[model samples]
Target: MKYLKNSTDTNYSMFLTNPEVICRKIGNGFFLLSSKKTWDKCPYVQQISETGAFYWNLLEKGIQRDEMLDCFLREYNIMREEASEDLDYYIDMLIEYHYLTKIE
Candidate 1:
């Protein structure tokens, strides 16, 4: 049997927002499609950062705060406090944009 090298840690459950919006992958990021009916003057497409994309993908399968902290810790040599702050900001942005939802 095969196993995923990095399985999701379920201590804290967080998921993506409803799949009401359309999305398309481009390079290392994603393009979110907004409906004209929802926002008559808003842009039809929105762009996100690479870090945002990473968290977005993780939200797809639900992830824990520690899991995300570990990811940042591995990707950079930042201190724990810095990592926590960054993660918090990332989550806040996603929440503000209605891209992420807390399951727990």
Candidate 2:
């Protein structure tokens, strides 16, 4: 599968606030706590499940998708195919919500 550079992700300046949420500015995207409060304010916020949140946290550290998929497959005791499908679905949702952007 093809992957875009981290730099192609969207600028999330409008979505973040509060120091306690623990945010890290990556190339363009940011990884932050998916808290209820944050979700409340940005109703469009992509609501990721716990597993999805785990991958998001890892991505913040510059981990790539393959590595994250490997970890999730091992940690969740799931098949690689299942992991990939879930990952793709959530990532697409994030993109659709403007939390992520493609590098055109």
Candidate 3:
């Protein structure tokens, strides 16, 4: 909700990648963890799905939420409603985990 208003339009411009957050490709999935610079209780290594890693890369590149949706729609063959719901849930989870920060 903070980063995305809806699937069609959004108020946020981009997500801020935490300086302490590190990401890596492990086989087919991704490995995510916080760096020593961050004292927060981030996990040592949180594994994510390939789809999740795809979105993570988009976020890491500072893509706007709406633009992310566009990319998602093009990359996957799912319905827009389904894609929107999935994206919203993923973004919300990332926000909760402090993996990404929203900007307006």
**What's the TM-score of each model vs. the native?**
0.59, 0.56, 0.78
lDDT by residue (13-82, candidate 2, tens digit) is 1121232344345454545544554464333233445776686665555556667687788788888887
lDDT of 3 by residue, 1-104 (tens): 12334343434344566767778897777888788666464566789877788788877776766778788888888888787788878877776777777665
Q: How many clashes (backbone atoms < 3 Å, residues ≥3 apart in a chain or on different chains) does model 1 have?
A: 0
**lDDT of candidate 2 at residue 85, scale 0 to 100:** 78
Query: lDDT at 52 for candidate 3?
Result: 81
RMSD of each: 6.8, 9.5, 3.5
lDDT of each: 0.58, 0.53, 0.71
Candidates ranked by lDDT: 3, 1, 2
In order of listing, the candidates' clash counts read 0, 0, 0
The regions of model 1 sitting more than 4 angstroms off are 1-16, 21-30, 34-44
Tens-digit lDDT string for candidate 1 (1-102): 111112234353445454554556788677766675634433467786666566556555455566766776787777988767767777666556655544
The TM-score leader among the candidates is 3
Shift in Å, residue 46, candidate 2: 5.0
- Of candidates 3 and 2, the better by lDDT: 3
